[model samples]
Target: MTPAPALTLARRQALINRTDMAGPGRLRLVNAAGQSLVSIELDQPCGTVDATGVALTDTEFAQVTTTGEVAGALLEDAAGERLATFTAGLASTIPAPELPLPAAQLYAGAFVRLIGAHIVCD
Candidate 1:
């Protein structure tokens, strides 16, 4: 597993958690090889790092559960370009909010990507 990167850009801390619709919604980044990356269980408006900069699918959201996984290509968007990392037998333990409360959910076989702070190019 890779280490947590330091927040360097202003947008790093500015990233807000995004939530998908309860019934159906887009997962964002998709793998061209046609494989499920991760799956996140959301019951309420769970905050997520949404890079698409698009509108939320549904404002009505819920909290994440331990049984869920965030499936999809975790990407790092830097300088307007999205980056992909190798997940070959690798698992990352992201710093989740906390236990015993409304927080993010993660499980085995979950896929994730790391994004940098800067969205602009030098």
Candidate 2:
């Protein structure tokens, strides 16, 4: 398996917010290859992230959960598995660890961006 990336990568990835394609009030996690990995359902008036999705796992399958609040938002799985580390609104250039990016980890980084946060995927 490949390792994940640092938190800052979330702000760096190419993000395409196609809420129209994703239906109403939704955000997508897509790859460079244009694969929509996951879709998060959001209620605009509520001011929170609420959705559960079936995402591909190393073995078979897993549920991707999203939750948002005034403090912060979270995207995680049943086992409390997190794809990246996240912090909101990165102001400066945060250094990235010198490593290779595998496809799965890249998606993890995007998940952080979907939640509108700076992320770390250690």
Candidate 3:
């Protein structure tokens, strides 16, 4: 049997993009009640810069929520190992802004290429 691929630190924000949120799709799984959830749309691609890059549009607000259950799900097991048991935390926008141009562009495209609107979980 093929070994299961090891999960890695993946950047997949496009999965939570606005367009995706606005359409019919899988309901985010939940393990708690009354948690906070937030999503943000940037005026320019906050993660991508350059002619080939994508900037977030300001027309929408970058959402922030107290609910972090969904965010917790996206994190790889290894990535979440350092976090405390509590799941309350804000998911930051794409990290590409903190990276160099080439890295940023690649990450930006990854962030925006999701089938629907992309969002950072918090």
Against the true structure, candidate 1 has what lDDT? 0.28
lDDT of 3 by residue, 32-97 (tens): 453323322323233332232223233332333342333222211222221111222222434322
Q: Local error of candidate 2 at 63, Å?
A: 3.5
> Best candidate, TM-score-wise?
2
lDDT (Cα) of model 2: 0.29
Clashing residue pairs for model 2: 5-121, 6-120, 6-121, 7-119, 7-120, 85-119, 85-120, 86-119, 87-118
User: Residue 50 of candidate 1: its Cα lDDT?
Assistant: 35
Model 1 misses residue 1 by how many Å? 26
Ranking by TM-score: 2, 1, 3
| Candidate 2, number of clashes | 9
Return the lDDT, model 1, position 104: 29
Segments in model 2 whose C-alpha atoms lie over 4 Å from true places: 1-24, 46-122
Candidate 3 lDDT score at position 40: 25
Give the C-alpha miss distance for residue 81 in model 1, angstroms: 16
Q: What's the CA RMSD of model 1 in angstroms? A: 12.0
Instruction: Report the lDDT tens digits of candidate 1 across residue range 3-83.
Output: 234433223334322222222222222233434444222222323333322221232323222334333333323222223
Cα miss at 97, model 1 (Å)? 21
